[model samples]
Target: MNRTWKNRGIVFTLALLFVTVEGFAQGNNNPPPKSPEVHGDQRVTFRIQAPNADSVKLSSSDIPGSMFSRHMAKNKEGVWELTSDVLAPGAYRYRFEVNGISVIDPRNTSFSESNENIWSLVTVPGNPMMDTRDVPHGAVAEVTYHSESLDRFRRMHVYTPPGYESGEGQYPVFYLLHGAYDSDDAWSTVGRAGFILDNLIAEGKAKPMIVVMPDGHTGPFGYGDELPMDEFIQDFKNDIKPYVESHYRVKANRENRAMAGLSMGGAHTLGIAIPNLDEYAYIGVFSSGVFGLVNNDGSVVEASETAYVKQNSEVLSNDDLKEGLELFWFATGKEDFLLDITRATVTMFEDYDFDVVYEETEGAHTWLVWRDYLIEFTPKLFK
Candidate 1:
């Protein structure tokens, strides 16, 4: 009798578990899709509730604007819904386009990134692409002053190399630029530039130097038809250089100073730094368009992009640059939309009897690739 009772109890427990599982499954026919959870201060999400609209498009930096077709069953109150997987954390600017007009997220109260007034801001946790491993991180200080040139308040972010104040030696400086629709924080905040430089300086790969990140999108100086080429030069000479010399203990000379940038920033650096050979000895351009091949007059000298590259192929021929300027480095991912442009720019440099360091990696136009480029490029500068 005791053995029979034990057997009955075991069977009854098993039956209860089976019923419970079946009931749970039946209750949830289609499981709810999980939203992105925070991962080590990383991950990002964008949501909009447009119940009446037929289609809504969401656009953000780096990622293309994606379209979402709303479904009544998936979204509450018959609203449109869309979500992104875990995204590398940092400040992101995005906008929603209902039909054709651009609008900020009605639900989100975050501030807009710029005055042009299209996209709003979203801050994520980790900036993995621009991660600086706590070697010797620097603080970001905003210095504001009246500018006689612009006749307005001018601000610049000055990055003092590790132990700048305690150390007696003056350091070299690199003026890093940001692309269009970006600001000075793009380097320190999102790019993790201070972290990268600190690590490089600690490892003895890069010489300790003050890095100046200036706002590159300042409109024409002194008004009256500002040329991109001329404005590019004026920014370095008038705005950026004077500020560094006055405030920081920087080596205000040509050999120790360097200039580099990406995309629009790259174009700005090349245009400004190349011809003014006396100002910057080391120069780098990452995934910049072939705007340099054109003349100062803004006219295309080379008949075709193909011919232009062929003409300047020697300077940017290989990963190991031949060296004409103190250091000429340019890199781009194979999948980058501007790969052809980088290749062409390299070719143009080579054809023009200039030597350049050219390299290609794997990725599209993104911060991930740009971050790695910093790692690789940092070691080469001031070497």
Candidate 2:
């Protein structure tokens, strides 16, 4: 009788569990359909439950442009789905366009700040350089400093390499700037600056260093015709440099300093670093050259409104200053829209008898190229 009762009890418990699971499955606790499902073959299928929407489209930074927008087909269940072509292994920023209205994927929790806007971030996870691994990891701290130049408190993301908290030595500093439409935080996140550095440092490919990512955009909003060049340079000189030197264990000299940027930030790198060439040992410009300096017709070269090229003529012609510059590197994608400007700028440097290492690589103006450039660039620094 006891055995029979025990058996009955076990059956009862399972029955109760079945009812509970059935209720839970049918209840509001059931999560919505997961979108952006990455498959083993590298293609990604996106899904959205838009019962009322007539049409849907998927657009991404990885998708080239609007010409490649993927159509999402709706089903009987009011759900829409689209599977993308096989993608390269990297992170991508994507969004859903429902009947011409732009919207982020409601299911995705991660987002990245881009050239002009924000997009949901998704990764396929194959590249080890940008992927998180078990290593002596560094920390990226969102730093707030008083920018007396801007008359407001500005923010920056500073990365201190592994063992920095306990180490007693000063490390070389690299000031990495972001392009337009992005702020300081964009480097650490969308650009994957911290992770790439971490991997390089761990692999013994790069020296452990403190990377200072500062805000290139100083305006109240987005980039306007005001050209944040002047004020940003002022902030870096008067506020950023002083604050960083005082607070961090930085090797405060020209030999220990480096600066590099992409696109608009590349223009910034040119404007700021070239004028003050004595202060930086290494400079890298990616996917950009001087913006206002060049024109479509390639006729006149005013050179960035301040007559920058003419004003800095002394430094441009000084061979001693060129000797001090360890690396004046420029890289642009072959298909990059700014390819002409990059080549012209390199030619400009060479014309001044300045040494320049220019690398024209495959691909276009995308974050993947920038990250790849960083992976290859940082390994050459501080040696």
Candidate No. with top TM-score: 2
lDDT at 19, model 2: 28
Which candidate leads the pack in lDDT?
Answer: 2
Q: Which stretches of candidate 1 lie over 4 Å from their true place?
A: 1-37, 40-44, 47-57, 64-82, 86-129, 165-167, 202-205, 220-227, 289-324
Model 2 misplaced regions, further than 4 Å? 1-31, 65-68, 220-226, 299-306
Q: Candidate 1, 10: how far from true, in Å? A: 66
lDDT of 1 by residue, 1-383 (tens): 34323543453344334323433544534332222223443545455444444555666654433323221222544333455555654445565655554555544444333312334455555543344465776555655655555656666677887677777788788888776655565766556677777777777777877888776656623334332445545756776688778878878887788888887789778667755665677888877756545555554456244433454344334433334368888999898777766776777666665667888888777665776777787777776
Candidate 2 overall Cα lDDT vs. reference? 0.80
C-alpha lDDT of all candidate models, in order: 0.61, 0.80
Worst 10 residues of 1 by lDDT: 65-74
TM-score of each: 0.67, 0.87
Q: Write the per-residue lDDT of candidate 2 for residues 33-145, one digit (tens) a residue.
A: 67789999988888766656677888876655433577889776566798877877777778777777666676677777554356677777678888888988999998889
Q: Give the TM-score of candidate 1.
A: 0.67
Error of 1 at 73 (Å): 9.6
